[model samples]
Target: MLLAIDLQSETPIYTQISEAVIEGIAKGQLQKGEALPSVRTLAVDLGVNLHTVNKAYQLLKQGGYVQINRKQGVIIEPNAFPIADEAFKQRLWDRLKPAVAEGVCRGVKREEMMILLDEIYRDLNKM
Candidate 1:
């Protein structure tokens, strides 16, 4: 999977890296057990600090999205992926609340928001 990061984005570099990897998994571009570039390699390739890539990898490992092995380096979790548990649901809801609130503030109708959401969901799945 190719990762593109915006240096100027308000989001932190590590967050962007982690999110891109997550999105790749969601899109089935990064299969289970697939190995990712080494942290140092990715950092050099992306012109970022090694710590940034390591931080992203650490987050992924903590989330059960990847495994780090001395021999294997980093790979997507081979045995299983995380299910959307209550905690995950709560996190998702928390993250989405702002966008929903923004829509509300802008007087966007429910149908309009739903339609927009549908379009984005479909677009991501199409990749």
Candidate 2:
């Protein structure tokens, strides 16, 4: 997985890392069964403490996005993706709600958003 952490972000480092990986998964930038870099490698790449990468891996594990193993390091555990936790779901909507509202303000219909979602789903599946 390719990642760039923003030390300048108001969000936590783990969160920055998690979101990038999750979005990469959703967008099919990282495919099922692809190996991600080890946490230490990622920390070195991002110029952050190794603990930050470990924390981010823990979050990804909690979110059911990746599997952390002693031998394989952090790897993408493909198939059977689960629904995100309720709070995370709410947080996602909180982020989307405003964008949708803005789209509505710009006269984009709700069906358009649904169609867009479908398109992205189709595209990702094609990957």
lDDT of 1: 0.94
Q: Which prediction has the highest lDDT against the true structure?
A: 1
Return the clash pairs for model 1, or none. none
Residue-wise C-alpha lDDT for candidate 2, range 1-127, written one tens digit per residue: 5687778888999899988898788778887777789988898899899898899889988878888778877778767678677987998899989878989999998899899878967876665
Off by over 4 Å in 1: none
User: For residues 9-126, what per-residue lDDT tens digits would candidate 1 score against the true structure?
Assistant: 9999999999999889877899899999999999999999999999999999999999999999999999998899999999999999999999999999999999999987886686
Q: What is candidate 2's TM-score against the reference?
A: 0.70
Model 2 has an lDDT value of: 0.84
Lowest lDDT sum, 10 consecutive residues, model 2, at: 75-84
Which residue pairs come into collision in candidate 2? none
Deviation from native of the Cα of residue 125 in model 2, angstroms: 7.7
Alpha-carbon TM-score of each model against the true structure: 0.93, 0.70
Model 2, stretches more than 4 Å misplaced? 84-91, 94-127
